[model samples]
Target: MRLAAYGLALIAGLAVTGAPNPAPQVTLDRAEAAPGEQVQVRLTGWPTGTVVIELCGSGGPARCARDTSAQIHVPGGGAGGAPLTVSVPPGGCPCQLRVSTLDTRFSVDVPLLVSGAAPPDSGTVRQAATGPPVVVGASVERDRGWPARFGAPARRTVVLRLRNEQAAPAAVALSFRVGRAPSPTGFVAPPAVPDLAPGEERVIRIPVTLPALALGSYEIHGEIVTAGTAHLVVVTTDHHPWGLAGLLALAALTLLPTRRPRRSIGRR
Candidate 1:
């Protein structure tokens, strides 16, 4: 029931911005394999372009073995393409097969099992005893022609809505970045906001600016960092090249002599 409510809330928030484009599908011939062993991976329903496939452990990039990764070029509208062989990284079982676009506008992760991995001990698990629960959601103003490009620059602000549900107060600094993927670059970091009282809600607006010539999908990511824990949020936008079709049609029209009037009759 909780999962369903979360899904409904997410859908409501992004109904205006539209969901991300469909990503390529991935399949592994074998569910479990020993480390350093190669497995056959099948791909299909790929609309187009290139993506990176890598193996990662539980944590973030720090836990991922970067050496065990590959860049796969997917054919346009691929239909059950040839199998791709990828070796399991050094990290043991309980890992993820990660696939993401170069810009990271779209991403998918599949569970991967590697032999000889030790499961987490049930006795050593820590419960959430510190820090208030922060619920974060982000959205772009699509109603005012957001994501606009071609004729007018497509730049907009991302509104971040945060609510603390628990009884504990929170004093955290907010920092974020806009990119194809979340990395250390071009960040809008402000000093820590006033301490948030228990069960308080706050709204923060961060303006996003993209290059005039920039084209393709982008992401707006925000984070609230504190000593006890960190809260992260993300929203998506695009710089759609609406003039591409018009440009192509114009070029074709130029190649046709019949479409031109008799302005050059005197020269002939």
Candidate 2:
């Protein structure tokens, strides 16, 4: 009788543990792309049991790996978004993207267009030059942290102040460069107007954010472009962490400026 009871208990435990749970399904919601332009692909409605996901072309045999496969996790009934930056391969063609769940065999297809270059945004901001001696503020590293105030999980707003000491109103363009990659061209923040009346001063404050920012020393600088002169100035001083992972992330940011470093004479 004791042997039979132990056998029955073992059978019950195995039956309960062997049940299959529904896996999280991954679907490619939509592709917002520009021909010859790198775009972010977003996914939605993911279920559980998906350890890995991959993208394959329906028309072509090319495949794009998940930027950070484990970065975004989905168990059952969870949703997530992944930012994929891929240069649309040459030519005008329709690319079908199939997103698959490695374990559950769940997937979806998204159609994307590889078209011409993206249109430029003609937004401009100007700042005037002023002063006998324009005194620039110096940046000192804080004792608390490398980027104590500017580190990761930061607020979206970046506040900066510019002083123009000249008597004539100057149209200055506010520009930013992280490492060596220049900020997106054609997107200029409105400038701070400084009083150019010799002793008069002006303060300009601008706020902006970079998508998917990584760890590094991010320098916010400005260039005052006039008829025949250009003044480049570094404004803020904030140092983020520089670990192995940060080095890798900065490597990615550096590549962003490669294709659009300067306008191509051939494209124009």
Candidate 3:
């Protein structure tokens, strides 16, 4: 009887104190996906704010290859949380999708399997005939249409031009790389393009962000069907003179003494 009374008291105390809730959890709509397929992700118990999501490979020397990883921002709040969509690129592999707060104080990793057979080529060649039916072009542009500055984020665009040389529509796989790294975002799995008619040319654009902190020489390479590769070189340097000066000024102000000013006594 005494033990039972103690148990009741403990339960009452817990109810009054309100136990802390469990950490955030993540769930996927499906366990596996094919190349170029989209997967739905759901997050629960996430705090109210912005969260970062990253998809990274699981094995091999290139386990966390930039091309295999993509970053996304999620606005999380409430019990329902938020829903996100991620694309699976070609080549089967065990991958992990991680979601976390900006500071990374709280996070969760969910395993995902990406598997699928490659699409067969139709054998339709382009009339331009230089080579493959697909051509890739890439360029880097800074945000706000400004030139690529040293300490500012830049936008990279990979454009794929498809030409239907055969009488019927043709299907092909496209991939891109930046400075020996796979395009950080899955550029291989873009939206399905409508069949192109004979002599039809279609252009598709894939964009990725290069953070402001990045510096040094980098190259962007785009390929179609392992042929018709295009390359672009980008050189970034530290060019934020104004920012550095401002930081120095702020530091100097902080070090100044905070004593109250002395009053003038001549008038009195």
**Which candidate number has the best lDDT?**
1
Candidate 1 lDDT over 1-268, as tens digits, reads 9999999998898997797766578888788877667767667766554555667666443344445555555655653333334444333347777765544566677887877765433342212214534756678864255334344555667776777665555544455666776552444433335456667888867666655655777777766643335577777777765675577779999898775566655755
lDDT of 3: 0.50
Residue pairs with clashing backbones, model 3: none
Per-residue alpha-carbon lDDT of candidate 2 for residues 74-153, written as tens digits (9 for 90 to 100): 43455655554444322223454445543224656566654453332233323334322243442323344334233343
Which sections of candidate 1 miss by over 4 Å?
A: 1-133, 143-148, 151-153, 166-168, 182-184, 189-192, 243-268
lDDT of 1 at 58: 60
TM-score of each: 0.40, 0.28, 0.37
Q: For model 3, state the Cα shift of residue 165 in Å.
A: 47
For 122-181, candidate 3 gives per-residue lDDT tens digits of 333222222246443334443443433434555665555666676543433234444424
For model 2, what is the error of residue 30's alpha carbon versus the real structure, in angstroms, after optimal superposition? Answer: 35
Q: Indicate whether candidate 2 or candidate 3 has the larger lDDT.
A: 3
Q: How displaced is residue 233 in candidate 1, in Å? A: 1.7
Clashes of 1: 0
Comparison by TM-score, 1 against 2, better one:
1
